[model samples]
Target chain A: MTDFWLAAALCLLLTMALGLVRVMRGPSGGDRILGVQLLGTAGIAVLLLLGAAFDMPALADVALIFALLAAVSVAALTRRRLTREDS
Target chain B: MEMTLQLWSMLCVGAGLFFFAVGTLGLLRLPDLFSRLHALTKADNLGLGLVILGLLPWAGDGFQVLKLTLIWLLVLLGGATGAHLIAKRALRADGEEMLE
Candidate 1:
């Protein structure tokens, strides 16, 4: 079970790395932000899997934090864009 | 019974990971922004939800299970809002009016 959890974590990390390719080459800022969004979700999964493998529930708190931050980051982008358009 | 639970957890987690991979593939290979955004929501909603559901069996306490469910709920709310904001911004930037 430990090995299974670890392997799942590794696979999620690879998914994150692949998401970066989209981030790097995305044609628009929105696309890049989308890539970032993918990273955030995948990162949370990784943290959870690692927490299970290592017997650390604290990591779930960390994952929670990541969730909040991810939401805020995109909102910030939208807010900035709104301000730019307004001014 | 314990073995059965473990197997169920493994199956769900594996399926979740596969969805995650599929979403990434769509993000990389899809032809347009809206299409890619479509892919992303799949990962956010289904992928993450399944993972948390799978981990419920391994949760150490009742509180832990509750916390995990809350985390998934938070992500669900956030992901939906973020996706909308992104699509709206992208649409405005393209000078396209929102579809009714």
Candidate 2:
């Protein structure tokens, strides 16, 4: 069980790395935001896997909060961007 | 019976991992932000859904099952909302570009 969890975590890390490459090299703010979105989802996955791997339930609690926060941040950013564009 | 459950879990997790891989590949190779978002939101959501479902039987308690399910739901909400926001902005930009 731990082995499978660990493998899932490792694979998520790979996804995060790929997301990072996009974040660093992406041509515009859109790509950066997209990258952040990728990171958020992947981060949650890693946390869940780690929770399973270590038998720690708390990790999932954190993931729940993280998901809400990630959405809020993107909403805030999008609001600001639209406002700035209109003005 | 134990082996069967384990085997089932393993397949689910493996499939989940493959979806993540596909999501990342689409993220990297897609031509634009909207298309990438399209790939990611669909793939990752399905991926995580599989993972959580796989972990359900192994989970130690009822609370853990609830927590995992909540986490998956929250992520789906976040991904959908975020992708919508990004796509709206991208479309706006596309419109502006067309105007110019």
Candidate 3:
């Protein structure tokens, strides 16, 4: 079980590294937003893995909060951009 | 005895990781914002969902697993909606030009 989780975590870390490359090289604001979204999702997965590994329930709550916040922030940024363009 | 369970767990995790990798690759190689959003949204959601599924067996109780599932669903919802909104606004702002 531990071995499985560890391997999964390592794979997720590699995935995050790939996404980081996108974040760094993204050509547009929207591309960057996409990268951010990927990061947020990956972060949630990491938190869940940590929770299971460490036997901590609070980490799940933290993951939930992070998801909510990331979503809200992205939406807000989009809306702000739209409004700014109209003005 | 428990080896089968371990194997199953590893498989799920491996699947999740594979999806994550696909998403990252798409993000890197997709030529346009909308296409990139497609890659990001699909891969991230599936990746996280698989991870949660893989970890479900390790959770202690029904409530714990339930909470974890809820988090996964929230992420799915948030991710889809967020991507939609951003893509819409971005397309509108840029007026259909491929971003340079």
Question: Who wins the lDDT comparison?
Answer: 1
Residue B51 of model 1, lDDT score? 89
Candidates 1 and 2 compared: the better one by TM-score is 1
- Candidate 2 residue A53 Cα shift, in angstroms, is 0.9
Query: How would you encode candidate 2's per-residue C-alpha lDDT over A6-31 as one tens digit per residue?
Result: 98799889888987888888866777
Residue A80 deviation, candidate 2, in Å?
A: 3.2
Runs in model 2 deviating more than 4 A are A81-87, B94-100
Alpha-carbon lDDT, every model: 0.89, 0.82, 0.80
Candidate 3's TM-score on the B chain: 0.89
lDDT of 3 by residue, A1-87 (tens): 555566677778778888888778777777777777888899888888877777787888899888998898788666643346687
| Tens digit of per-residue lDDT, candidate 3, span B1-100 | 4777667777887788888988889888878888888887998898888888888877889998899888888988898899888777786774543232
What's the lDDT for residue B6 in model 2?
A: 88
lDDT of 1 by residue, B1-100 (tens): 9999999999999999999999999999999989999988767668989988889999999999999999999999999999999888777665532221
On residues A20-39, what C-alpha lDDT tens digit does candidate 1 reach at each position? 99898888787888987898
What 10-residue stretch in candidate 2 chain B is worst by lDDT?
B91-100
Tens digits of per-residue lDDT for model 2, B1-100: 9999989988988898889889889889999877888898889888988988888888889988998888898888888888888788767774442112
Tell me how each candidate scores on DockQ against the true complex. Answer: 0.52, 0.53, 0.63
